[model samples]
Target: MDFSSKLYSIESELTQEDLDSLKFLCLDLLPNKKLLSIKSNLDLFKELEKHSLLEEDKYDLLAELLYIIGQHSLLRILGTNKWAMQETLKKNRTVSLYRQMLFQLYEDLTSEDLKSILFLLNIPKKYEENKKFLDILYYLEKNEQLSEDKLDVLEKAVSMVSQELLRKINDYKKTRVKENTSTQSLYDDKMKLSIEVVEQVSSQDRGMKSTVELVQHVSEAANGKDLMDKNTESCMSDLSLNEQSETEVYAMNRKHRGYCLIINNSEFMKSDPRLGTEKDADFLTNVFTWLGLDVQIRNELSTQQICDCLIDFKQRDQTERDCFVCCILTHGKSQAVYGTDNAFVHINKITSYFSTKNCPTLAGKPKLFFIQACQGKTHQGAHAIESDAVSSVEERKTKITIPDDADILVGMSTVDGYYSFRDIRKGSWYIQALCENLTKMVPKGEDILSILTKVNKDVSEMEYSKDRKTSMKQMPQPAYTLRLKLVFPIPLAPFKPLFQETN
Candidate 1:
């Protein structure tokens, strides 16, 4: 009944290949360096236990991993069967989109077909030694000829090998296109709402001063109450009285854009030290500072310190500043992340600290939380989705009301119950993509949500496919309640800092 005993019982039922598959399924969940040394099921469980992912009462992750690798016979050791797992994961599968794609390709491709495709690819003859189709795909990824976004090289080679495989690739591309279109449509809806609000006001009052007056009137009339608080005032006042931009944006012209808090937890008391987080911290501090925000970095904090830090910010009077930003880089699990002491700090608790009731000053201002942590331990594998009839788009009437939780954005490194990846050498996939997108996209006037959409696409395309079995993938998730467009206009010149940088 104990956790180690359960793992030992499972180990007896598994062969070397089964163990390898289990480890492969865990590639996205566990550290690669630790996984390499897991020659037995017990060893793998030990690593999971170290991360607080497995316990005597909590063996669901282990069971899911076994089920994912098709070691179904071993599932009963954890008191679950394949049929039950099938139903449980029907709506929420753990295998990543990238992994499922490669697995499906391997299952359909013949050995001869692989050889022919490899020949067409003109891959080095040395790779000809690789017999598995997945191995060949790994080579393509390693050589930078294939990725989630780029499949031209594989598509061309596969076309000559088999039309079915080519169709599969095309289906995957269609799904990606549809997803992108859906995201763009959401952006368009927000923009439309902005335009509708403006047009409604413009129909009656055309001047810049009238625009502000109309916003307050329309909002009050639509909501049937006075909701124009200090935050709403800040949102509207960001626009110049004499000259308004073509599009409305949240105020970012203040000399100080409030605090950009970077909580970088690299060292842990129990868990593996997070390597390469220094790069994320450094990059965020520099970029946010350049964007006219006061950057503060806090390295290696316990759970108490994290709570204390949030309380400190929540209590601060941010009336003079324009917005707030917080970045958390650490190990995590479902709905919560770990501190240096390996304790849980629920994300709800963190976000609640900045609620309008909790922190009145930040009520209307944007409070951005960029969390570089995994939401869960599930691995996302790619799969083909059959095309369905497109539904007709509908437009709805717009109403503006500032809820208690408005102006908040939480950018998660991965979706719920999945892993987010990091390189020991180059920092995390989410942070790297996020910083890169912000640096590249902000100057072009894209709002934060749009920039985050680009970040989602960039991180999803990345894979740590060292080999076919250990191919890993990640997807970033963004959730926001922002009422107005949040854009950080590039300052004419980087503001000289007056505060000392803290490590």
Candidate 2:
């Protein structure tokens, strides 16, 4: 039963005392002897928490209030929530004004029998998130205060929303696919034209003619530059190796490809040499190259060299690129990797280089770090951690600390304080699994993080037992401070751009 109907059915059994109690409750909720605020209804429930009434009594009172409010022409049903009968107050709008507008909208909506509700619920579905709309559905499902039938209606409504959302998404994808096909055709024509221009000029080079000059003079180009040897390809780079879904081929703002920095530290003098590191680099080079990255492979780097290499990359212009990725194949300790000089460079230092404040060109772009190194010594332990001892009390005040707002992801070969599993023949388990899954999942339209999760699951589940009692287990860990969903070989329409909203 609806809240109103249920209250009407039970009102016959209630005495004057019960009705009086509800009237007193409602009166107490009024601000300064009047319904002075829009939060009066919300405050009524909040204040009811202090009462010791039975659950049924509380329900009865709530239903009675709802019924009375509806009957008294108080249809301005709205709260701070998005799907509330009223509109949510904006940050700049006062509650009273917001409430008035919400009621006006509600009045307009009710005249058409819930037309607004259906329209609001049908939020546009994309690969990116729609937080407000999705949250409203979540709120409806989790609200236990509503009756069963009402909840059922909400569930069905949400189901229809999902169905409609899916159809719209599929249609959108079809349209994009069509658009992308046209783009591809245009790119191919440009490439063919450039090739013809280049080959034609080269054929007549015996005369006083330079093909470079001829191509530049004849072919129309952007920025007065010749479009020769045009690579008619799309790159997924760090986010994807082959997934076309993640590719943003036509983005004039984003780069055609990102840069991949490979640091292979194998010549460890103070420690055991990390063999098979080259295999990892070679394989990744091919993978990332196929994925459309400008692959840079460096060998035998010291701590300072590693730092300097990153600094150099950071200094270079990357505004034309979508992201930056670094892969280090080396031995390591907890939170640090060993350079060829056997010096330790903390991982955070490397990541800090790409922060929005430091790397302005890559401000809003993704920065991926794939480290194949040991964290520290570890063993399986599951127990309650003892609390820290109390210290001398001092004056304290609340302080709002904001987190770093940059898109950076670090993928580790093993959990902290654990050994990474590897083979002298096949290279490290994590890197191998990452490469394999990237190849497999990219075509299937899986995003970078999902692909990484699969890599982690597969690596952790692998059995490398020397005997029945002895085995090796390696769990990869990916830590990220990403502000947006990242896909490779393609880009999705961002609901809103982060880090690029200029002053």
Candidate 3:
């Protein structure tokens, strides 16, 4: 199936009317520009006015028209002159539509419009229902174009919309049930199935919301969004005290030191070296170092050596250190990672050392582990006809096991029963995506979990084929029991353009 095509179709369904309104609005908003194009602005506006008068639900259409007018002014300021407009048209792209529409509306968008959109967002909402609109607003906000007053209005609007929508939905359902009793059995069956599906969706939504809330609280505390005057003890007991004080007790001192250990055990017994493991170690080391952590890279370490390193790191002084990250790059079999000596070690032994009871220093801190190894012996190779000439090698055993209390986040390269990709000269597919995602997300105030989620998405979308003709897919999975959110410093924060005006 063409997933992209299906997604486009669905998006079209949602935004069809919006798009039509946008086109009509653009004609009025960009009269001079429209005069330069094939369509006459006057004719289009006349038709739109007629349609607006006849339509019962004209608010959205009017809003779109106003938004287009705002966008036209912003575009002019952004130096999108006649030539640029013509170029956009030649490319067969609609310049003032969807995400692009927000840019055009940026200059003329009023506080009310901003509030209306924000109000829609503040209420209980599904991201899918309004992601595009939110994306546009976020873009404008990021550009320092959105006023604080507008943002406040938007927030209240979102809350109000959410409440109103909920009430309307409930009322509609009740009325439909009462008025359509003749088709009761059919309705009953449909409603029963709908309720079951909605329940599942609600459960998933709750899980996501809980996760997001935890991350948001952590971010706010870390970024000084809610700082407290008192220390940990007083802040925890006092309702008036801000939560930042409590979080500060567990915060990683910026000046404090931390270490990273990278272990690569790619070679199996009588097997050639695997570059994927080496790349995993290298990528992880770079990421940690970028985050201001002292890093040590080790290759071809035996299982015992790996264990000893973790034990030593756990014994470090809490006041002088921050967090620890361990990256294991190796070939494996079922819940275990392999060492250079062909030794089998359970992953739990490496992680268990940093638990609350074992390592007091890292008790409430974050401990991250990136594992790039096979999880099982099952081979998922391409068929002979479509497969590459490369012959399949015998499956190897994994030696390391992970512990339950490790407070460690493990990001595995691929799901079990699948082969991870590695380039002989470069690195593994997972490492490339991991590096890219970390580089992008870390600067955007995203937590470790959010970054990992993006990495999972990138890996899932990538396809690998054994022979040039066959396709096999592999996706990475990040499993974590993190007690705290990990926030890396943004290197370019000081240079960001600041907002000067309020709505």
Candidate 4:
């Protein structure tokens, strides 16, 4: 079969991820502009064919690239196996030292390291948007900002991120110098052969053969460098998350932290208006916005609207987000919170919208729901200690049901069969305390559970007074199926500037 037909057969077997790897490997072989347009393996093979590196008779470069990328199984299409290629590479491998070094650096640098490196780089905002290391390197090459010989900017950037990475750069530099020396020696040997060919006039055929061998050697060396570049690019693309450090902390590195959807049902059609729900919504928006979330408040949603809003949020492409937050401020009953239309939306139904089967994007990420409503009509009375703190408490109580899934946290205004307090002027006792603790404790590097514990403590101490005596008390509750600790560290830049909303 012809080379193009063979490539077509190979392409059919490879996934999009495999194609991406193949394209990455070609970074050194082709220009950035060309690569950006070459979407498929056919397009890539055409470019290689034009360069005469992937013809039917000459495909060792392709074989070597496949071997480097651990796709030696694919080498069967090129009529080669890993064993034969391994033996060939042992004597003379073509992939370059510089390319291999960069691949190692790309593999070694953690996601945090990539961010740090990107911060240190002086590239344009457009290029910096792509977090992929290969793309960044391509941008550097395209802009003529970095190259094999130009190691200053890269070394400086690596030094700031990691000493080990910097060491790799230095090692590459040392090895590069040695390669230069060896190339100069090869040049000297070629010159010596030229003189020998000149002196051997009687043996014209032998002199011609010697010159041909020298030319072939030079061509092979060039091909070797090209192949190495491709191999390095492709290998870098294959980096997996499993290679990263095994940590208990969930990854929270994203452009936007996640969405904070607040359903603030203040005015109800059938029931009494939630007096201080506006304050709760405002506080939640500010707190979540300060924590780097995109806060959106939906006022007075009905049962259907609430369900649709949650469904919309769950169906959204949350690939770039690290967490999902939904805050509900309304009236409540036994096992559910009441919509503005006095319809009961069960807490389980609300949480089910973001379950793994429903919302795969948020499968392993933290999903936090904070409810500010009463669970029952039963008021939590203070038995041992009572203090004078008069706040109008909500008579409607709501039960919080946690879904049987991992990485979910439900913060209830009060425990089952109990009334939760809400001041006419301020907000719900649970929400105000929750927001206060989030603002105070998040900056102190406290986890969400720890902050919630503090909220419980703060709310449990307060008492509402009817006439002169303290009459009502409330205790906030937290139900969690979290696998990892969720901590929102205040950004280095001040929190005040991160969020600006009118209360």
Best by TM-score: 3
Q: Write the per-residue lDDT of candidate 2 for residues 281-300, one digit (tens) a residue.
A: 87788777767788999899
Candidate 3 regions exceeding 4 Å error are 1-250, 378-406, 492-503
- Report the poorest 10 consecutive residues by lDDT, candidate 1: 384-393
C-alpha lDDT of residue 282 in model 1: 79
Expressed as tens digits, the lDDT of each residue in 1-503 for candidate 4 is: 88678888777756665566567676777765787788787787788888776788788877777765555456777887655665555445456656766766775677888988888997678768855887787677677778888878888898988997888788777656655665565566556655564455335566456667765654555445544555433333222211222236677897779999999887877655666567778788877887889999888889899999999999999989999999998877766877777777788889989999899999899999998777675343333221111122434444455777799999988877667777756667788788888776665445788789879978887876664655567888899999987877554443452234334
Candidate 1: where are CA atoms >4 Å away? Answer: 1-246, 378-404, 493-503
Clashing pairs in 1: 95-380, 95-381, 96-379, 96-380, 96-381, 96-382, 97-380, 97-381, 97-382, 98-382
How many pairs of residues collide in each model?
10, 13, 29, 9
Candidate 1 per-residue lDDT over residues 1-503, each given as its tens digit = 77677788788767776666666556567886788688887787788898887888887777766765555556767887655665554334445445555656775576678778878988777766744565566567668887778888888888888897887777667655655665465556556666777677767646645656777765545442223233233322321111133244687766567999999998877666777688778778877988878999998999999999999989998888899999999877766777888776878788889999999987788999999876654333233111100111222222222234888898988876667777665567888788877766564445798789989977887776645788677788888888888978655552443434343
Rank ordering of all candidates by TM-score, starting from the highest: 3, 1, 4, 2
Q: Could you tell me every candidate's TM-score relative to the true structure? A: 0.47, 0.44, 0.48, 0.47
Give lDDT per model, in order: 0.70, 0.55, 0.53, 0.72
Which candidate leads in lDDT? 4
